[model samples]
Target: MDKESNRDEGQAGPVLTRRGFLGVAAAATAATAGFAAGARAATPGKDAKGDGGVLEVAIIGAGLAGLTAARDLQRSGCDSFIVLEARNRVGGRTLNHDLGKGYFTEAGGQWIGPGQTAIADLARELGVGTFPNLWQGKMSMVSGGACARIESKGGFDTDPRLTHELEEMAKLVPSGAPWKSPRAAEFDAMSLGEWLAKKNIPPEEQIGWATGIALSGGTAPARLSLLHWLSMINSADNIYERLEAVKEGAQETRISGGSQILSIKMAQALGDKVRLNWPVLRIENWQDGPVAIHTPNGVIRARNVIVALSPPLCNQITFDPPLPPRRREMQRRWPSFAPARKTAHVYKKAFWRDKGLNGWIFQPKGPVLWAYDNSPEDASFGVINAFVNVSALPSDPKAAEVELSRIYAQALGDEALHPVAYYDHDWGKADRWTLTCISPMPPGFLTTYGEALHPPAGRLIWSGTETADIWAGYMDGAVRSGHKAALNALHAMNERRA
Candidate 1:
């Protein structure tokens, strides 16, 4: 085995943030310790590709990245590409669960800000449908069990300094380019909590919003670099302007049937090019020419390949000679943003709606971080998706359901409806990809490893929601990265023939 492949075979998960872990440990009721530690040892598997004519390119992970690459490749008139997906489904994070309540519920990514992100544009191009989430009634934030309606309230920030600090910090960030400012970059190096401390904000309010952001990033806030925060702010600012330009509200849109509609459309548009249930077990790059992908079914020899997976997974793919020291170091420095685990429950009704609530509860303590009213507008059953904050939940279906109910009651109210069925997939526990979200660097991470994250390594050009320049975490980001990778691949193909 090549060093790259051997490294992938012997690799471990991202290291946890020390201070961040301590903070969360203090408040987190459930823990995900030893989750990845127990993953099965790397097993060799057959390649899924057939002995058909040599493929010009193979795009792995048919989610948004692979699908976007396929669509763009088709547009560029490149017909010799194939999309391989591990799961039977196509949409990577744009997943929805049918809890048998009303309509489909989003288990992966469900929100669509008016960011005009590449995914949004692709949806429009593919004629995928969308609608505004009817986040009707009021939203509330709960801390220390105190409930206050958000709209008519000036909710207290435990520390007033952090609020001003973040706002002032926001001003230093240029309107269009967040990555350009050295001042901004400096703040990006520190943890959000550390930034608050620098601004003289107390720990209480800082931690509350810290919890909010950690939940938002699907990783703890303290572990997130301030740079990531600024990048996010810049993206949100772009989104804000687009919404204002279009006269839309922050109560934004979602896929009509679900985001997966876009995935389905992209896959269908690719015709026979998309291969489902084809998991890429190993990738080898030879110095002479061509890259080899090993799957369960057969080997696929391609002139080039787009990894289109999270960095954590990238670390899992073995390279023949080995990735450059800098790139390998970049992978080691950055951490995966995928959550430990998440659970979505299907309830019998939109029970929280009856109480004039949208079921958005921010808990400073507990396993449930955020819950949403995912009930499809036209469904009979009430479907809701909850982001389970911990990874230690047993794999048993019944146990997960019981734990979810307990979380709802504690975070929201005792009146929160009991779910009839539950659905969950642990992104972190998956051997291939542990992080549910994308890879995010610490404060200096982007400054130190930003360039390395984008460098096309081996035959492996990377793309995913995190690779996007504008909307890095959302589905839109995934589409952007795909378009980018396809362009690079197509250019290489043309140059090779030229």
Candidate 2:
């Protein structure tokens, strides 16, 4: 049997199936071979073909934003458009890959917040249901080399005084929305760490907030600017109902099948309008005519383009005539490191769930900074994902496993079961165009480029979770950007017709 077959039969841990890995690695080769086979013309040249002036639209990056743009175009009676995806798959950051045993887990962007209209709307249209995350079991805590479990009805107050101090700090800051505060700009410029220090919070309390938010949203607290956090407060300002929803005991939902199902269905619905293996290299725009997009295959023409990839990847495409000076500068100021790597380990079984552990362990100094049960509902399989703080894990996989094991033991109790397997992707090292997540403005976003980031400059329309009026860094934001951009494009098209 081949290695791929062997892996399916018994082998596990980190190694990709031969066919799966080879298929992704050899995408260029396959594309070239397919082109050579006369599958379709290798080059796309501008032609005044199609009856009634074809309004060709080219979208770069096929993640949530890109896919949404295509769907909206279809809804708007658009006939000609192309979705250029650089990755092997269409989901972009929300990919779900199989890990043997008929199970799969998210490669990136796992959670969906309630009331996020974009993703929620897509899910409703596609019939995908969501549940709240289950973190209700007895949780574990590790601090200053000591560990303990907070039983049911017990809060994570390893140090009562420290917890009180942190609570005080939370109280000092205006709850809900701080954006309109006269001190908003000044507050945004401050770092969470600096704020904590200024408030005289204890070290344990500081680390709790820092590490908690880092693992919670996959960002380090110190790295996030005060404005970013306040922006979150501002966005959630009217979210008092969110607490009520949580009080009802909810489970964070995954697509009944998986997020990939949504992507597959979206693509299937688009048919030929969506082009796979089309890697866009540059976008050249003319003031009067359609915009020209150059990919490795050739040049594509579009009436307008929607860029949905992360900020880092959007920077890769050189906009001919260059993006407006302010937009270019905003791109420079945007943070790239916020979307760091988030990893998980899948198990043959979810033994911890039965042990009254919610699979949440906070280890300040381990490769497995945090882990959760991202398993599908069958209860037959469970995946344990960890986010490694270190740039590179120890060369030895066993050592890495041991480090995770030790951390989980202390945090989840010494009896925490050993994981059957592990999975992670280095999103932090993803290229200039693609990183793990969107970086938030450090303290000076509001004072520097806050409002400027959202304004449209010429043909360019910015949409991502960060650019969303609500749920800025979540899947909802991505959906909102795409929906809004589509509306904006449709209005422009209508005006031209009039």
Best by TM-score: 2
Task: Give one digit per residue, the lDDT tens place, for model 1 in 154-202.
Answer: 1223344444445556555552245566685577668765765556545
Across residues 51-79, which tens digit of lDDT does each residue of candidate 2 receive? 34444566676667777888998887776
The 0-to-1 C-alpha lDDT of every candidate, in the order given, reads 0.58, 0.56
* Residue 418, model 2, lDDT: 61
Error of 2 at 425 (Å): 1.1
Model 2 spans > 4 angstroms off:
1-54, 143-146, 152-182, 216-218, 238-251, 395-399, 409-418, 430-432
TM-score of each: 0.77, 0.80
Model 2, CA-based lDDT: 0.56
The positional error of residue 365 in candidate 2, measured at the CA in angstroms, is 2.6
